[model samples]
Target: MKILQAPFTEEMMRSLRVGDEVAINGVVYTGRDAVHKYLHEGGELPPGVNLRDGIIYHCGPVVMKEANGDWKVTAAGPTTSIREEPYQGQIIRDFGVRGVIGKGGMGDRTLAACAAHGCVYLHAIGGAAQVLAECVKRVRNVYLLEKFGSPEAIWELEVENFPAVVTMDSHGGSLHAEVLRHSQAALAERV
Candidate 1:
């Protein structure tokens, strides 16, 4: 598996290709439908958060706060990425996000945006919440918790060895598209 650090550079994203297994380290941010919709509708992100060259995760993690006020991640599995399709491309472009981690894959617009913006979409294993959470080293910050609620809040996290596969790359490659085409062809053969 290729090891990657957070705050990825454009060159790094461009170097990645579909099907490459990667283990990510450093920081990543979590956001879901509400967050995407807010951003897409011209809502500004909370001040002090920087997304440029960073990773965006489609997830709703379960977190617990300790007696000393530190937060612990209990579950961090990926959410379905397609749910954010309408806003993903624009979000990547606007925020300069270098990587996106989620379950399943995105659509044509997102794929095109990834290619155009030097971004890659990484697919994390679904239903591996607890296992994934183990990779989170710390909870750096949380935003919009009151406004969007816990699950829909934006979580800034520091992680190590977070496993994922490149299903969409900056070079116009998409494993999801390939699978769709093959499935359609198979259906045609049956018909």
Candidate 2:
């Protein structure tokens, strides 16, 4: 598996191709619908939260607060990435984001942005929230909790060997598109 971490560079993202399995270690930030819309609408990221060369995970993790006021992620599953298609491209360009982790893939706009901005879209496992949470080594921080609630908040996570498959690459490759193309052609042949 390809190993990835924070401060992802253009060269690193460019080298990845669709279908490459990667193990991402280090920092990642969870950004659901609210967080995406907020960022797209020109809202500032909380102080200390920087997305430059960073990875944004489309997830609404199940978290628990401890007696010490620390946080724990009981589950970390990917949300449907298609929901962010309208804002993803712009977010990648404006925020200098290098990676996006989610499920169900995205649209042409997002793929184009990945190609243009040296970014990659990784498909995380669906229905494996608890299993994936095992990769989360720590809860670093969180933002917009009071405003957007826990699930919709931006959660800073430190992960180890977080697994994902690259469905869209910076080189204009998309496994999701390929699957759709082949499926459509097969259906047409039957007709």
Q: How far is candidate 2 from the true structure (C-alpha RMSD, Å)?
A: 0.9
For each candidate in the order shown, give its overall lDDT on alpha carbons. Answer: 0.94, 0.94
Q: What is the lDDT of residue 102 in candidate 2?
A: 98
- Candidate no. 2 TM-score: 0.97
Which residue segments of model 2 deviate by more than 4 Å? none
Model 2 score (lDDT)? 0.94
Worst 10 residues of 1 by lDDT: 4-13
Residue-wise C-alpha lDDT for candidate 1, range 1-191, written one tens digit per residue: 99998669999989999999999998999999999999999999899678899999999999899999988899999999999999999999999999999999999999999999999999999999988999999999999999998889999999999999999998899999999999999999998
Model 2, span 1-191: residue lDDT tens: 99997668889999999999999998999998999899888999899899999999999999999899999999999999999999999999999999999999999999999999999999999879988999999999999999999999999999989999999998889999999999999999998
Q: Residue 91, candidate 2: how far off, in angstroms?
A: 0.5
